[model samples]
Target: MKFPISWFIGLRYTRAKRKNHFISFIAIFSMLGIALGVMVLITVLSVMNGFERELRERILGTVPHVIVGERAQGVTDWKSLEQQVLQAPDVVAASPYIDSTAMFKSSYAGTEYGILQGILPEKETKVSVIEDYMISGSLNELVEGEYGVILGAAMARNLGLWRGDKVTVLVVEGSTVSPAGISPRYRRFTIQGIFETKSELDSRVAMIHIADAAKLLRKGDKVSALRIRVHDVLNAYMTSNYLRANLGEDFWVSDWNRSQGPLFRAIQMEKTMMFVLLTLIIAVAAFNIVSTMVMVVTDKQADIAILRTLGASPSTILKIFVVQGSINGVVGTIVGVISGVALATNLPAIVKFFEEKFGVSVVPGDVYFIGFLPSELNAVDVTVITAVALLMSVLATLYPAWRGSRTRPAEALKYE
Candidate 1:
């Protein structure tokens, strides 16, 4: 049950109340600072993680992970191309699609431009979660030749259209040569469904049956591309490159990175910046430990001289101070981690409570992709924060401890 002499004395010194209340106050302040820094870092990082997850699951989930297409002309043999796409590594599902920009005009809502996409309901379900977000009607209602269309919720609201309402689609790809200097091809489509993604896409995307899109565009049986969903969205860029290499130069393979890379990259950069900025809080707290330790060393000078007289070495005095300073860091880090995790796990509820109490929305659906603040605690984030705090704490003790160790036994006791 015997402890090392240095450790025993260090523990005793830490437990004893300081005669100088100011020194005690500094020590307590240092401990609290470390705890606050760690807690804020953990909670903020968790919230960022949640936003990234939502981007992948909610926003990207509605779009294809990868697209395989012919460089010249549409994919005439889309069925075969779909099969090839499915054979590629990481490919989970493949569906043929015809994507084009078109103007949609409704009698009640006027006109708006958006991406018009053609899809087979059954196959589309495998590549995207559009079916899950349907607010009314269903993708199955998009019968071939029926010219039925699905509109985004915002688009539908703006157009003042509902199920069975008619909208005219105008495309410039298949204009006819008339005496009136070529006319744009157009078609009337009945609204079959409406979906709400709560994303930017909700205002600028529309869908219809593949056959109808092909006919409207005069592409015959050909499709613009084969949409591929991968097992992991994070690796879509690599998977797309692999497909491109294997599919040859005649075909082009693209992934979500082509369209959404900038957005996600911006998010990642923000996360990195936040991590760097927040770490300064912990660094500042660690500095406070230095000042606190310095004061302690000054107060304990006579004690150090007495211990040295009793055969304690300089190294022993150093170890004693290091142990004492480290205790503050250890206790603070433990408290911070516990509270941070608790706060992070319940962040959504806390946000909701505040919103309800104040009658103000923290995240509005119109302004953001999601309507509520989200949080996802990561173990790696917690571990890294803990390691940084502890390292800083231990490092902060070094200079003060070294100074304490250098105390002259004769000089220190001469004053007493």
Candidate 2:
């Protein structure tokens, strides 16, 4: 196969021998650096993607898709409102709830404040996915027993309480008596079950029977909000808008965005920041491409001059360098892609293997939301990363190629 003399010479020069041994090592390191950077960036970004996916599945699946409530004091007929909203397109399940801030206490520890949501078991199962992640006991326990309560895994950890353990709550809403005002009401509850959502919900919220929570709140058979679950979460905002338009101005509706706004935004922003920061590694490594090509031009100055005297065009010289730099990009990118994909696709298993062998968690449950680091290789993300690296590689060639083109045929041969 015939090849351009410039390409043949360019490639040969790129492979450093004894005289240019240091250049060879620098070239190798540059390739490795690019590989490492691309690998880490892909791996970290994949993990972030995994976190986002888990949040959507485990947290959003169990939280309300949309919540409708009366904005002002007195409670309207939520049951009637629920019926109307249920008829909205894409709304799958709707349940009434009474939410209030309360202080919970137990024998082991005291002073745990959290949001207590009153849910009707039968109705709630249709709405939230918590029924799937119940670690212990049953949701039916709440319906059967008046004093039954369910706690999130993290909240349970904080209280040092477990299923069948007795817990007491001081309801803030019931602090006022009809004649005797500002008297706190206390109720004893048994821990019926524990749930593991592995998100912020696990640390901050607990559940009880709807009737019991309403009674405790002194709402007298009324609910402050109706939690609605839709067939599609991506369309949650649409559902909220539909409910708001139909329910009129007196009623207020909240989507998952409103309920978990800060958390979702923070996660997204952190992921973005991580990708940006990690890309710097790739950028730094790519700089080596520029340096390597520059050195190559210096070492081959005489050859370039000879080629210029032999009728080779400056554009051809430029193409030669560009091609050489691009080869570096291609080889580095391929190696990084393979290794990074392997690491990401198997992160869960990799962490598990290390934890079991070493007898210590790589990703401890206490620190992160998951006990292991999660990773997901997204095609779009990989494509974007590769594209950026390729672009950087192309850019790196321009200076060296231009320098090669400017070689004076006469001066370069003066030593001869």
Candidate 3:
């Protein structure tokens, strides 16, 4: 099989040993640099993607995807409204809840302020995963009229309280007016359960039976909101909008986007900035090919003159050098992608191994939401990185290849 003249010569040039070892060094360096840059970018992006996924599962899992509430007062017709919400597109389950702010004080520890939520244990499971993280007792222990409370692990720790312990809860929202000014409503409740999400919420949230919450708030058969879980959490915002439009202005529809959107958006922005910054490393490495090719053209002046004299067109000369330079990009990109994917996929295991070997924790569970490193390789990320690298390599070759093609045959021969 005969190869094209330009391809054959170009390949020959790539494999040939050059007299100037400096040019050879630069070529090798550029290839390695590109490989390193690509690998790092892939691994970092994968880790970021992993963090995003973890946040969604760990934090968002226990939070409502969407909440439907009355604009004024509480949701008096929540049972019927919940049925209506269930009929909405993408709605998987709906549970009635009462949200209130309160301060909890324990006899053994200090007072802590947190969000106190009221929920029906059975119905709560349909919308949130609170029951899954229980450290002690059960959500079912929160019986109506018992005024039972569920404390977050961190909050429980800070309050030095445990299951079956008594905690005093003070609510300013439902305070009563008295002769000695407004008196804050308060209740003493026994802890029924404790849960840990390993997140900030663990220190900022508490829960009780909806019936108990209703009585404390002086609300009869009314809930603060209808918590809705959707089939796809990513579509929660859209679902909220649909519910808002259908449920009318009298009802307020909110989603995770309102409460947690900023955090995720910040993560995304950081990822983008990191991508742009790291891409510069690859760009610098890719541009190194320009210097490598330039030196190659200079060293091959006599060869170029000879080829031109032998009826090789300037365009053919350009193609030869372009192909030679492109070989470095292709090889580098392939190596980088393979290594990066491998590293990203096994990152968690690798971190675990090192942590075990060193007798140290890279991600502490109590300090961070997760106890181990995580990674999630994305095909789109790999593809984009590959394309960018190849493009940069090809572009870098243009100037040098064009200069080589413009060499004068007569002048080159004279010097040779």
lDDT of 3 at 246: 96
Off by over 4 Å in 2: 1-19, 72-75, 105-111, 153-160, 172-180, 198-204, 231-235
lDDT of each: 0.92, 0.83, 0.92
Mind giving the per-residue lDDT tens digits that candidate 3 earns over 1-416?
Answer: 88899999999999999999999999999999899999999999999999899988988999889989999898888889988998999999999988889999998888999998999999998888888889898998999999999999999999999999999999987789989998888999999999998888889999999989988877788888898999999989989989989998899989999889999999999999999999998899888999999999999999999999999999999999999999998888888888999999999999999999999999898677888888999999999999998899899899999999999999998956
Which pairs of residues collide in model 2? none
Model 2 per-residue lDDT at 364: 76
- What is every candidate's alpha-carbon RMSD to the true fold? 1.6, 3.0, 1.4
Candidate 1 residue-wise lDDT, 1-416, digit = tens: 88899888888989999999998898898899999999999999999999999887987899789988999888989888877777888889999989899999999969989999999999999989888889899988999988999999999999999988999999987779888786888999999999998887789999999989989888888899888899989999889989988889999988899898899999999999998999899889889899999999999999999999999999999999999999999999999999999999999999999999999999997788789998999999999999999999999999999999999999998879
**How well does each candidate superpose onto the true structure, as a TM-score?**
0.96, 0.88, 0.97
Candidate 3 has an lDDT of: 0.92
